[model samples]
Target chain A: MYRYDEFDHAFVQTRVAQFREQVEARLAGQLTEEEFRPLRLMNGLYLQLHAYMLRIAIPYGTLSARQMRQLAFITDRFDRGSAHFTTRQNLQLNWPKLIETPDILAALAEVEMHGIQTSGNCIRNVTSDQYAGVAADEIEDPRPTGELIRQWSTDHPEFSFLPRKFKIAVTGAAMDRAAVAAHDIGIRVVRNDAGEVGYRIYVGGGLGRTPMLARLVREFLPKDDLIAYLEAIMRVYNLFGRRDNKYKARVKILMHEAGTETVKRMVEEEFARLPRAAINVDPAELARIEAYFAPPAYEALGDEPALLAAARQADAGFDAFARANVVAHKQPGYAIVNISLKPIGGAPGDATSAQMRAVADLSERYGFGEIRVTHAQNLVLPDVRQRDLPALYRELLAAGLGDANAGLITDIIACPGMDYCSLATARSIPIAKAIAQRFANPARQQLIGELGIKISGCINACGHHHLGGIGILGLEKGGEESYQITLGGDPGNDAAIGKLLGPGLAGDDVPDAIERIVDLYLAGREAGETFVAAYRRLGHDHFKGALNADRH
Target chain B: MPIVTERGFGPDGWATVADETAVADGGDVIVSWKRFVAEAATLTGRAGRIGVAVGPDFDVDLHVAGLDGVALVAIAFAKFADGRGFSIARRLRDRGFAGTIRAVGPLIAEQAPMAFACGIDEIAIPDDLAARQPESRWLRAVELRAAVSYQRGYRTGASVFDQRSTGGAA
Candidate 1:
C-alpha cells in the first residue's frame, strides 16, 4: 500500500477541517439544505432512505490491516453493527447521523483514510484489479497508475463539477478483473511491439438505463500523457455534455448523441492545446509511486506444501474451500484466498464488525498485513501461504466467513435495494438471499459452475447487472415490486451487455425464474463449458423460451 | 453588494449593462454577448473599456475573436449547480484572456475557491446567498493548504508538477 506522504497527510487534514466547518454552517442554518446537498455529496455523505450513509474509498481496492481494523471500529461505534462493501470497492456505513459524520471522517483520517470524491459529480474512486500486483498473468502492476490517477483527480479544481458522476477503472492483466469495459474511462496497460508499456484508452462505456460498451478512443496513449489525455476527455465532456436532463447527463450520453469520431476529434483538439510537458507526471514521481507497490520478500520453496495436500485429502470442507476459494499466487508457495461475504440467506456483502476484525487479524497473522476489496463485494487475503490453508479455514469457519462459494452460483453480487436506497424501485437483497438459499447445495452450485448472478434495485445498475451472466433488475410495476431478468452479459475482456429475457416477474417468483434458466443451461451445456460459454453457444432464444415457458 | 475576490471582499469595479435597460451613466459597462456581437464595432471604438456577460450556452471559441478590446468578461451560472460557467471561464483563460473574468450568479461561498481557481477574478453573488454565507466563508475557501497540486496548469501557473517536469527541484 502507498503510505501517505507529508502532502497527502496535510491535504486530508485540511479537507477534514473544511468539511467540519461546512457541517457547522449547515447546522446553524446559514446554508440551506439545497446549498449543503452538493457539499455533503462531495465528501461522500448520502441522504439515503433511512439515515446518512458514508462511503469510504479504499484506494485501488487496497487496505492495510490497520485500516481494516479502523473500519471495524467505525462500524462498531457509529453505524449499526455492520458495514456494506459496495461494487465500487468501497465500504458504506449506513446508519450514521448527519452530526456524527465529521467525527467519522476525523477517525478515518487518523488511519490515513477519507471519503473524498466517493460520491457526487466528480472523478470517483479509481478502481483496479483486486489481485493487481499478485496476479500471475499481469503485464504490470496497475496500482501505481491507480495511485497516480487518484492523486491527480483528488480536489481537481476544474473538473470537480462535471455534468454527472464519472468513474475510471484500470487493469494491467490480460483478463479484465476490474471490469474495465463497463467504466466511463477504462485503461488497459499494454506493451507495444518495442516492449514499451502504454495505455489502451476506452471511453464512454457505462451501465444505467442505457448500457453501452466503451469505445476505443486512443489505440495507444503514451504512459507519460495519461493525465493530460484524461483532462482532454473530461474538458470535452464538461463543455459539450448535456446538462438539461439529469438522466441524460452522463458522458456516455454525450458520446452517444455526438458520434465517437466527433467526440474523439474534439478531445484530440483539446489535447493538442494542453501543455503536455507540464501536464504529464514526472518520470521520477512515477517511479516513486511504483516503488510503494513492489513485491514483498518471499522464501524459496518447492511446489505444493505437504501439509496443504494432506489437509485437502483429509477434510471435505477444507478441500471444497481450497478448490473454490484459493487461487494461484505469483509466488510459488503463496496463494490468494477470497473470503466470501455472501453466505446463504445473508445480504451479499454485509460483514459484521467482529467478522471484519477476524479478517483483519487473519490477514496480519497468515498473510501480509494487507487486504483487498474486490468489485464483486468480497474480501481478499492476497498473500496467504499454501501450508496455512487448514488453520485459516478453521478460523474462518469460526468467524462464519467460511462459505465455499467463491465464484459459484451461491456467491451473488447485489446492491442495497428499495429497503435502503431512495432511488430503488424494489428490494434486491431479499431476492439475492432467496436465490442463494435455493441454490445452497454445493454440488448443485459446482455443477452449475461459474455463473455470475448480479441484481440491482433499479436501472442505475450499481450492482453491475449489465455485466452478469444471469442479471436481474428489480423495478416497480403498478405499485408492486417486479423483477426483470437478462441473459449473456459478461464483464471480462470480451465484455457484452446482457439482453432481456422476458417480462418482469414478481419478487416472490424471481428465484424460480433464475432456477429455470440455470437448469436450462445445465441441460444444454457441453463438456467443460461455463454458463457464459453455454449461453453464447445456445443463443438467448433458448433461454428466452425457458424463462417464458411457465410464465405464459 | 459584496463581490468576492482572491484577496477577500473587494469593490465591484465595472458596472453591468442590462439588455432591456438603458445604458449606465459613467463607469465601464459590461453588456450581454448578444449586444457585444451586434454592437462590437461601436463598442470597440469607445474611449473606456467594454465587457460582455455570456450565458451558459455561449461559445467562447466562436466569439473570442470579437472580444479583442473587452476589459472584462462575466460568465453566468443561472443555477448554483449548473457548472457550465466554470468550464467557460477556464476556456477563456486557456485562450489567453488576460482581462478581468467574473462569475455572475447565485453560487454559494463553498464554490468560491473552485471558481477563483478556474481563473475568475471575482464572484458576483446574489443578495440572498451573499447574506446567507457572508464573506468569511468565501475567504476561507482561498486559504492555501501548501500541498503541491499534482495536476498541470488549469488555474494557477506552474505547480510543483510543472517544476518537476522541467528539471527543477523534485
Candidate 2:
C-alpha cells in the first residue's frame, strides 16, 4: 500500500476545508443545485435515485487494516451500516445525507483518505492487479506507478472538466489481471531488450454506450517521460475531443470518430512541445515506495507435499477450495489467497463493516496486515504463505467470505442494479445471487473453468459487463426486469467486446439462459479450452441459437 | 440597486437591450449578445471597444475563435451554478482573447476561488449580492492552499499534463 507523504496529507486537508465551505454555501441556499452538482461530484458525492451515495476511493484497491476499520466506522457513523464495493475497486456508501458528507470527509481525512476526484469528469481512481506485488508472473510491482498517477491526476486544473469520466489502469503481470485493455489509458510495465524498464501505453479504451479496446499509442514509453506522454495524450483529447453530444464525448469516441491516425498525430505533436522532466524521481524514491510493498517475510520451510496430499485425500472441501480459489505464487511456500466477498446465495461484492474488519484481522493474523480489492470484487491477501492458508481459510470461513470460488462461474461480477442505482432498469444483485446459488456445485463449477459472467444493471456498463466472457445486461420491458445475455466478451490480454444474444430473458428465465449458454460451451468445446476461446472459435451465433432454442 | 441585464441577439451582435429603440444610443457602454446568432451585420466588431457578454451556457469557441477585431468579451453566469462561464474564460485565455473577460450575474463571493482557477481575471458580482466585509478584489487576502491556482481537475496526477491553447491567440 502507498502511504501518504506530507504533500499528500497537506493536499487532502486543504480539500476537506474547501469542500466544507461549499457544503456551507449550499446549505445556506447561496449555491443552487446546478451550481453544487459538479462540486459535489468532484468530491465523490452523488444524489442517486434513492439517496446520496458517497463513493470513497480505495486507491488502486490497496488498504491497510487501520483504513478498513476506519471505513467500518464511517458506514456505522455517517451512513447505513454497510458499504458497497464497486466493480472499479472503489467503495460506495448509499445513504449518506448532503449535510453529513463534510463530516464524513473530515473523518476520512483523519484516516488519510478523502473522496477528491473520485467522480465528475476527472481522472478517476487508478486501478491495477490486486495481486500486483505478489503475483508470480508479474514483471514488477505496478502500485508505484498507480500511486504516481494518483498524485498527478488529483485536482488537475486544465483536465478537470473533461469530455466524461476517465479511467486508467496499470499492471506488471503478463496475464493482465487489471484489465488494462479496457481502460481509457492502460499501461503495462515491461522490460526492454536492454533490460531497462519502460511502459507499453494504450489509449482510448473504455466501456460505456461504446466499448473499445484501447489502441496502442506507444509500444515503449521511457520511465522518465510517463508524465509528458500522458500530458500529450490528454492535450490531444482536450483540444480535438467531441463535446457537442454527451453520448459521443469520451476520448474513445474521439479516437474512433476522428480516426486513430489523426489522434496519434495530434498526440505526437503535443508530446514534442512539452517541457523537460524535473520530477526528481531517483532510485531512492522508487526504493521508498517499494519498501512499503516489500515482500512479506517467510520461513524457509520444506514443501507442503505431505499436508497437501493429506488434504486431497481427507477433505473434498479443502480440495474444492484449493482447486477453486487458490492461485500460484512466485515464491515457494506462498500462495495468493482470495477471500471471496461473494458467498453462495449472497449478493456479490457487498461487504459489511464487520466483514471488512474481519478480513483485516485475518490479513494481519495469517497474512500481512495488507488487503487488496480485485476488479472482480474479491479481497485478496496477496502474500500469504502456503502454511498460513489453512488458518486463514478457517478465519475466512467464520467470516462468511470463504466461498472458495475465485475464477469459477459462480464467482460472478455484478453491479447494484435497480436495488440501489436510479439508472438501472433491472435488478442485478438478485440475479447474481440466484445464478451463483444455481451453480454452487463444486465439481460442476470446475467442469466449466476460467469462466467470467458479469452482470450489469444497465448499458452504462459499470459492471464491466461488456468485457465479460458472458455479459448479462439487466433491462426493463413493460415494467418487468429482464436479463439480456451477451457472448464472446473478454477482459484480458486479448480483450474484446461481447455480442448481444437476441432479446432479453424474463428475470425468472435468467438462470436457464446462462445454463443454456454454458451447456452449449460444455457440449461442443475441445478439451482444456476456456469458454472464451471456445466461443471465439465457434462464435456467438451458435451460443445465441443455443440460448434461444426453445423460442424457434 | 440591482440591474437585470436581459441580453438577446439581433442582426446586431450580443445585447442586453430588449427594446430596439433604447439601444440606438449605444451609450458610454459598448454592446454584446448572450449567444452567437449568425447575422452578417450583427453587433460591433472586435476592432471597436464593444464588450460581449456570453451566457453561462454559450459555446466559448464561437466568441473566442472570431476575436480578430473584438475588443473585450464579458461572460454572464445567469446563475452561480453555471460552470460554462468558467470554461468560457479558459477558452478565451487559450484562444488569446486578450481583451477583458469578466464574470457577471449572481456570481457569489465563494466562487471567487474557482473564478481565478478558470483564468477569470475579473468578477462582476450582482449588485444585490450582500457585499463581504471588505469586498473581494485588489486588496483581499490571497487565500491559496495549493501551490498553484485552479489545479483541481484531471491534471491532478502527480505528473505534468498539457492544457490546449490552440483556441487562443499566438
Candidate 3:
C-alpha cells in the first residue's frame, strides 16, 4: 500500500536504465554470458527450460487495482496471456522474450513495481501476511517493517553478492500466515508484558534439500535496532558462511555446522560493534510508512451474519462459496474474500489476463481498490462488504474465478515443476490436477476440511511442500517420475517440518496414494480435528500402511 | 594496469615494491601488510609516502591503529563478483582511515558507483579490462544518481526518508 516516493521512483528508474544498458551490452557481446548471468538474475530474469522467465515482485503481497490492471496489461502484451503467482507472494511471467525484458521491467516500474532483487544471491523481496492490516488477530501490520527491510536490502553495497540467496518473512499476527519460521530470517512482531511493542527474531530457517526451522536468536529486539541487528547477522553470515559447496552455502547450514549458540554469539558481538543509531531508519519514517496501511473508509454497519445467511439460503452455490472463502475481518461488516486460483483440473497458480482484469475491476468497485496475493497463490479482496458479497460472487463466477474450495482438498499448492522449471525432476502440475479432480465435490471437500496438499517438483521446495499438512515431493527414480509423501508439516505459529512417509510411488498412482491417506484420516479423526491434528494423533505409521494398501 | 580516480587518469603514484628488496625511491611504493609490519623501521625513512596493499582476508581493523604512517591502502577483489573488498573499504573509512583507498580487480564500469560509494578512492583494473571498458564508461557509471540510495550509512546518499524530512515529494 505504500506508494513510491520520489527517491523510490528515481531509484527504480535508474535501475531500469542501468539494466537496459546491461542488456544492450549482453546483446552486443561486450559482456559474456557468465558476466551477464548474475546481472540478469538480479533483475529477476531467468533463462528457464524453454524460454526466459521474468519474476515481478509484489511488495509484501499488497497491490492496488491500478497495479493489477497494469499486470494484466503486461500479461496481454509481453507474455502469453497468463502469469504464475509464486509461493513467495510474487508473480512470474514464464514466457517473456529475452530482448524485451527491459521493456517489461520499465512497464512494471510505471505501476510502482519492478523485478529488482527478485532473484540472484542478494536479499530477496521481503514478504508478510496477505491479511496484514485486516486480520482480526493482528497486533500490528508487518508491511511497514517489510517495506523498510526491502528498502534497506535493495542494492545494499555490502550484501549485493552473498554466499547464497537470503529470504525474510515478517508476521504481525500471532498466527504465522507468512511462513516466517521457514525463512532465512523471520520477524514476529510482538509486545512485552508491559505493552511495549518489539520483535522476536528467528535466524537460519529454510526449506531446501534440508529443511530446518529457524532458531530464536533474539527473544525481544527493540524495534529501533531492527536494521542494525540484521546488518550484524548478515555480516557474520557473509564472512563465515561456506562457499566450498553450493548446497552448503545457506545460513541455515552455517547454523547447523557451527551450532546456533556460536552464530548467536557472533551476531551479538557484531551488533555491539556497530553504531545502531547511525544504521537504523528514523522512527518517524516507519510511522510515515505505517500511515499508508491505515484502514480504509468503512460505514457504521453492524454484524452481517443475518444478511449473509439470507443470501446463502437463496443460492446454494453462493452459500458454499461464502462459507469457505469468506474470512472474518477486523472491521465490522467487512469480510476478506479469497479468490482461489486453484480450480479443479487447472494448474495451481496460473491466472489469465482476463481473470486478472476482472479481479482488478472487482477490487475497485466492491472493495477498497486494493488486492493481495497470498503465499498459497490465491488473490484476496481484503475489504469486501457483506452486503456486496452476492453481486461480487456473480461477477467472480462468470469469470471462472468462483472456486468455493479455499483451504479445502481441491486448493492445492504446486510448483511449475517439469513443465517450466529445468530444476524439476518430475511433473507436479498433473499430479495436482489429478488430486483436485479426485476431490472435486464441494460436500466431500467441506467434509474433508482444512487440508493443505502442497507439491514441489524437486527438493528446492518452491511450492513449500515442507510446510503442507499433506506434502508431496516429486522426484525421479531410474528415469521415471516418483512421488513421495510427508505428513503433519505446518507453516503456522507451531511450525514443524512434515515427517516423510515410506517410499516413492509412480506419478500415475499419486492420486490414489493421497486418497488412501485421506481415507485413513477420515476413518481415524476425532471430532473437530483438522487433517494436521488427525495426522498428529495417528502418526506416520498409521499413514505408511495406508500408502501400500492398493498394492496389497 | 591503469588506475582511475574521480579526478581523472594520472601517473601511477604508488608502485608495488617487494618486501625483502630495499628501494631508495620514496614512499610512493606500496608493500604488502606483512612486509609493512616486518620492514616498518627501514621503510619509514623513504622519500615517498608508504602504502599497504591487503588481500581480501586482511583485517582492516588490525591495521587501523597503525595507519598514521601509511598514506594509502589497496584491497584486492581477486574476482569481480566477490564484494568483500567494498566492506573493507567502508570499514576502513568508518574507522577514520583518511588515506587513498584503491580497489584492485577485474571490475567493470557498472561496479564503479558501488566501489566509490563504499569509499574507494580509485579502481586499479587489469590492463585488458581497462582497454575493453574504457575510462568514459567508468566516468559515466560513477556520475549516476546512485547518491539517492536507500541505506543510511552505507553511503552518503540522501535517503528517501531524508528527502522526505527535507520536504521533497515523490
Candidate 4:
C-alpha cells in the first residue's frame, strides 16, 4: 500500500482547511446553498434524503490496517455504526452531519485519506484492479499509474470544473477486474510486440441514463506519455462536450455525437500541441511510486500447503468457501481471500464498525497489514497465506464476514436506493435482499454458478446494473415500482452492455422472474459454461420467454 | 463590475461596448466577438486598443489569426459552473496571444486560483457576486491555493513534478 509522504500530507491538510472555511462561509450565509453545493460535492459530501453522505476515497481500493481502523473510528464517532462500500471502491458514511464533516475529513487525512474528487464534475478517484500487483495475469502494476493520475488530477487547475463528472479506471491484468470498459477513460497496461510496456487507452465508456462502452482511442500509448495524453483527451472533452443538457454532458455523448475518429483526431492534435516533456512526470518519480507496490516479503514455500487441503476435506463449509471465496495469487503459497459483504438477505456492501475493525485486525494478524475493497462491493485480503485458510475462515465466520458467495447469484451489487438516495425513484436494497433470499441455499447457488445480479434503483446506474450478467434496473412505471431485466452483460475483456429482456415487471415479481431466467440458463447451458458464456451461446431469444412466464 | 487581478482589486482599464454601441475614439474599448469580426478592418487602425469579449462557446482557433492587435481577450462564463471559459483562456495562450486574458462572470472567490492558472490575468465579476464575496476573500483563496500544485506548464512556484525531479521536498 502507498503511504502518504510529507507533501501528500500537507496537500490533504490544506484541502481540509479550505473545506472548513467553505463550510463556515455557507453557515454564515455568505455563500448560498446553490453556491456551496459544488464545493461540498468536490469534497465528496452529498445531501441525501435523510442526511449528508460523505464518501471517502480509498485510492485504487488499497488500504492499510491503520487506515481501516481510522475509518472504523470515524464511522463510530460521526456516522451511524456502519458504512457502505460503493461499486467505485470508495466508502460512504451515510449519516455524517454537515457540521461534523470537516472533523471527519481531518480524521481521514490522518490516515493518508481524503474525500477529494470522489464526486462532482471533476476527475474522480482513479480506480484500478483490487489485486493490482498480486494478480497472476498482470503485465505491470497499475497502482503507480493510478497514483500518478491521482496526483495530477487532484485540484487540477484546468480540469476541476469539467462539463460533467469524469471517471478513469485502469486495469493491468488481462482479466479486467476494475471493469475498465464502463468508465469515461479506461487504460489497460499492455506490452507491445517489442516487449516495451505501454497502454491501451479507451475513451467514452460510461453507465447512467445512457450506457456506453468505451472505444479504443489509442492502441498503444507509451507509458511515459500517459499524463500528457490524458490531458489532451480531457482538454478536448472540456471544450466540446455538451453542457446544455446535463444528461448528455458526459464524454461518451461527445464521442457518440462527434465520431470516435473525429475525437481521436482532436485528441491527437491537442496532444501534439501540449508540452509533453514538461507535462509527463519524470521516470524516477514513476519508479518511486512503483516501489511502494512491489511484492511483499514472502517465505519460501510451495503451492497449496497440505494443511489447506486437509481442512477443506474435513469441513463442507470450508470446502465451499475455498472453492468460491479464494482466488489464485501470483506468489506461491498465497491466496486472495475475498470477504463477501453481500451476506444473504443483508444490504449489499454495508459493513458494521465491528466488522471493519475485525477485518483490520485479521489483515494484521493473518497477512500483511493491508486490505483491498473490490469493485464488486467486497473486501479482499490479497496476501493471505494458504496455510492460514482455516484459522482465517473461522475468525471471519465469527465476525459475519464468511460468506462463500463471491461471484454467485446471492452476491449481488445494489445501490443505496430509495432508502437513502434522493435521486432514487424505486427501492433497490429490498430487491437485492429478496433476490439473495431466493437463492440462499448454497447447493442451489453452486448450481446457478457465477451469475451476477446487479440492481439499481434509478437510471443513474450507481449499482452498475448494466454490467451484471443479469442486470436489473428499477424504475417507476404507472405509479408502481417496476424492475426491468437485461441479460449477458459482462464487465471483462469481452465487455458488452446487457440486452433488455421484455416489459418491466412489478417489484414483487422480480425474484421469480430472475429464477425463471436462471432455470432457462441451467437447462440451456453446456458443460462448465458460465451464465454469461451460456447467454452468448444461447442468445437473448432463448431467454426472452422467461420474463413472459407471468404475463401469460 | 469589479475586476480581481493577482494584486487584489484593480481598476477597469477598458470600456465594454455592446454589439449595437458605437465604438468611440481615443480610449481602450472591449467589444463583442460579433463586432470584432464584423468591424475588424476598421477596428484594427482605430485610435483605441481593441479587446474581444467571447462567450464560452467561442472558438479561439477560428479567430486567433484576426486578433493581431487585440490588447485583451475577455472570456465569459454564462454560469459559474460553465467551465468552457477556462479552456478558452488556455487556448488563447496556446495560440501565442501575448495580450491580457480576462474572465468575466459570477465565479466564486474559490475559483480565483483556477482562473489565474488557466492564464486569466484578471476577472471581471458581476456586481452582486463582488458584493457578497469581497476582494479579501478572493486574495486569501489565491494565496492559499498557490502553495503547491502538481500540474506543470502553468504559472506556479511549486510544481510537484519539478520538486520530485529536482530532489526538493518530497
Query: Which regions in candidate 4 have their CA more than 4 angstroms from the true location?
Result: none
State which docking tier applies to candidate 1.
medium
TM-scores for the candidates: 0.97, 0.84, 0.96, 0.99
For model 4 chain A, give the 10-residue run with minimal summed lDDT: A543-552
Candidate 1 regions with alpha-carbon error over 4 angstroms: A305-307, A549-552, B20-26, B144-148, B157-170
| Better structure of 3 and 4 per lDDT | 4
Q: Is candidate 1 or candidate 2 better by lDDT?
A: 1
- lDDT tens string, model 3, B28-129? 888888888887887766788888889987776677897778888989888777777877887788788888999988887767777877889888888887
Tens digits of lDDT, candidate 3, A333-422: 889999999999999999999999999999999888999999999999999988999999999999999999988988999999999998
Better of 1 and 2 by DockQ: 1
Candidate 2 global lDDT: 0.74
- Candidate 1, residues B22-119, lDDT tens digits: the string is 66445688999888888888777776688899898888877787778999998888888778888788788877789999999998886777787778
Q: Put down candidate 4 lDDT per residue, A470-495, tens digits, no spaces.
A: 99898988788888899989999899
Interface RMSD per candidate (angstroms): 2.7, 8.9, 1.8, 1.4
- Evaluated against the true structure, the overall lDDT of model 1 is 0.88
Instruction: Tell me, by DockQ, which candidate is best.
Output: 4
Every candidate's DockQ is 0.53, 0.10, 0.52, 0.71
Judge candidate 2 at residue A205 and give its lDDT: 93
- In candidate 3, stretches whose alpha carbon ends up further than 4 angstroms from where it belongs are A549-552, B7-11, B18-25, B40-47, B60-68, B145-147, B168-170
* Candidate 1 lDDT tens digits, A167-284: 9999999889998889899999999998999999999999999999999999889898899899889988988898889789988899999999999999999899867775777777
lDDT rank order: 4, 3, 1, 2
* lDDT tens digits, residue span A336-452, model 2: 788777888888888888898898787787667888988998888877777766667777788888787888898899998889898898899999998998898878998899899
